[model samples]
Target: MVNVGAKMDERMEINILDYRLKVMSIAKPAIERFTHALIDVLFFKSYLSGGCANNQHGFVSVTETDADYSVIVEEEAYKAFEGKSQDVKVNEQTWLPLVASTGPAMVVQNAAGISKIANSVVIPLADRGISVYPLSTYKTDYVLIQEADFDKVCEVLAQNFRITREGHLQSSEIVVEPTRVQKALPSGAGNSRALTHTFDCSDTNTYCMTSMDSKSLEPHGLAIIKALLYSGHQSEVQTSYFFNLSIIEQDISLILNVTLLNKFPAHLFFDNSEYWRLITIGDMPEGVGFRQAGIVAQISEPIASADISEYYISSFYYGHAFVPFDQFDEVRRLLIKKQNSQKAAAAAKLSNGL
Candidate 1:
């Protein structure tokens, strides 16, 4: 829905996992033993439907330290292993369980440098809410993501990256809009010391305010204020400042028109230069006497400017507003085209030994 244009790339779906899985950490000194357990469960026990196809084989992350080697496997696989061998001690925990996309994901073998993929491919996808897990190889770096999310992944990579079931490179043009809400703030807020101003809207009584100066307002704050003023689509929001101050009872009732402070949970509007974000979790039902906007929360990541390649993306702020959900097909089309373009560029660089 973001007007990405007509040139859409081809999307291919692959087999992936269905249900969520619990993590089973197997501490075994011999890696071969763990491999044998999985082989036995798959070949002899036949707990899985078939070999990797249809995602019968789930995600397994193994970490090898000097003291111990741990093999974290899927829940179903662990159960099958337990059925086969009762003596093995398996620790089951919910620490960051691997969740793969539904159906077979088209795996792309990108013969590109890790740093290049990190900056060019991974960072862009992450910004668009598409997660790509890069599996490293001797010459080619394999990029894995759920087939369902591949279109969006490809769209984010469009123009600068490429993807092929067979390792071939392609190219395209890409347009990047880095900010969320582009609309300028009201002229009244132009003054630095301004506190609050009420805008005339056709529907609701909207009051816009800044706890601090206009310069202190980050992209996150501006986006929230804009969304509150206008009817737009906002999915997720992230910020670095937290609010704990309490508001007086009468002011809370007058402002939000709710009796229970917990129901209306008022947070102090500070003018301090800090990062703040309001995330629209879900649609609010009719007649629930509260602000239509979603939860307002903040984080601790400092407000700073740094390039994605120069440093870690910890302090970066990227927000999306007015994303067109109705025009999904068009969005996907633009995404795929951009992905091919990126791939072509990367391939060209690799061929020239860049």
Candidate 2:
């Protein structure tokens, strides 16, 4: 573990280890293909947040829309009927024609919940054209190609997507002791009947202040406050918000917990967009240049890649070295050794100078 003073040397300024990563962009044709574009035709929504039932398996969207693909293929089949031996074709016994099971039929639905039957089902549909993909009875509309056409499509899309290696700042949890937190907070902050909470998680909006007048909360602020209370915090009386959104309203649903325990509430608020959802606290710290660090050491060990994400140091801090927890002890030991080696090298230089 890293000691509080590890490599400190009184270094408080944020040490950013920046690196450049390359990202592949789609070409004009690919862009025109409209990858990851939402159809919103089916509008398949559930009350749940996420799980395997919600998220993807190996590769969920391996479709023509992928930058890794180019062409698309489709097929349509017809049944053949034969005549009976007698002059009267079906007088004796009628015969039925069977269609090939190469691919199954699917349905397509529009925004109005109106449905249409499609000729065939597209597993991962094409990027363009009228197509239908089956997810049980509720079919999603999209441009589709046949699985038999996979190779041709992928050949066109291959390498259209390039990989970029970007440097990142690390993330670390700051477990503030309630005592220390209490000291940090202004007095009279905790003695509040009305809670002022920013209706958004991102701190880019107005701070929330108290509202003693009992009022119905919009659905927006409901979930997080419930979490705070359900965490079993002493919320005999707490503030709330309801974030019921309208199609026309542009307000964001991201509310933040900004109310002080008792004093006037302070925090930022904004509609939670994609960028806000995928950021770290360090990315938007409460104050200027706030950083958190932890220390660990291993006497003798090798590196492991499985636990890199757990080592939350912003990439800005650790360079390209994604130190995993299993190997973190090794890193500490190696760092200590590197320091000793560097000092020895310096001393040798000085001795030679002497």
Candidate 3:
């Protein structure tokens, strides 16, 4: 628990939804006051277990006064935070001496000019080339600074501006190395054709859980891609979520329309019984095959969006009627008019100015 009061300028705003982090002077007495202050605020009775003990950092737990409070004294944050070294603020003139650490970085244009000051040295996490923003973005939570210039930069930060503890923050970390395997628009995603499933979910090959390392699952994958590529496809997918699982008509695994269990049929990758089979408007499985029409496909977001540091995300080459999920219908209608518009919108910026 902590015991300190804070005052901020009316214009400054920092909103951390669930976790609360308030910073006070990182000194000895100030630390004590801050700890008690936290205690006083957190004194309410928690319906369930509450209290802190030693943690990964070997810090002592907070001392609770309430007899009913969870005996496991809430671990005191100040324990570790106390007597710890603080990061001196950094500036642009500073050289990032070390290989930049990978993580989410907050680019806050607290006032206006700080970004400019930081830009001479600090760079947004994803940008590789020369583009820069005054209200530019940041690559890591911490600023990039030369260890030698650290003190000089901090002086400028503390004196000239206060970093807003809030803003549009983007993270460049992802669990999966999202990969996209290109395939013919009218065809399925990339995968070794050798592996095959019991039921070919493809337009040509019917197989379930095929050993084939297929990216798009033909006919089945097409349905999903159809919904994903186009916007209005949400209903098709939303409705499909219900059929995620239903009583099976065939001992032979069959996919079922999550919504219209009676209509569309294909083997589901996930068990609907456990109820985890909802289709996302964004993702489509690879290795599935479909009727070829020489059309192209594209991704909705950037390749970097996958948190991938490398990999050039190219525009889908599929020549089909490509329409964003939002303009699916308009694009679909355009297709009806015999226009070779699989997708009118560029998934990402493509080689062509289209």
Question: For every model shown, what is its TM-score relative to the native structure?
Answer: 0.27, 0.18, 0.16
lDDT of model number 2: 0.20
- Tens digit of per-residue lDDT, candidate 3, span 1-354: 111111211222222111112122222223333434333322221211342211111111111100101011112333333344442111122122111111113222231112222221222211111111111111111122333433333232221122222222532211111121111121223221111211111111111111111222333544532322232234544312111110100111222233433233434343333111111111122211222211111211111122211111011111011112233333233323322232232333463656
Model 2, residue 248: distance off in Å is 24
Number of backbone collisions per candidate:
23, 52, 75
Better of 1 and 3 by lDDT: 1
Candidate lDDT scores, in order, read 0.28, 0.20, 0.21
Q: Which candidate comes out best when scored by TM-score? A: 1
Q: What is the per-residue lDDT of model 2 for residues 1-354, given as tens digits with 9 covering 90 to 100?
A: 222212322322111112111111122233323321211100111212332233211111111111121111100000011121111111111111101111112222221111121111111112221111111101111222223332332222221111111143453222222222111122212211111111112222122212211112233234333322222233542332111111101111211223322222222222222110111111212211212111111110111111112111111111011223233444445445544665787799999999
Alpha-carbon deviation at 203 in model 1, angstroms: 65
Q: Considering TM-score, which of the candidate structures 1 and 2 is the better prediction for this target?
A: 1
TM accuracy, model 1: 0.27
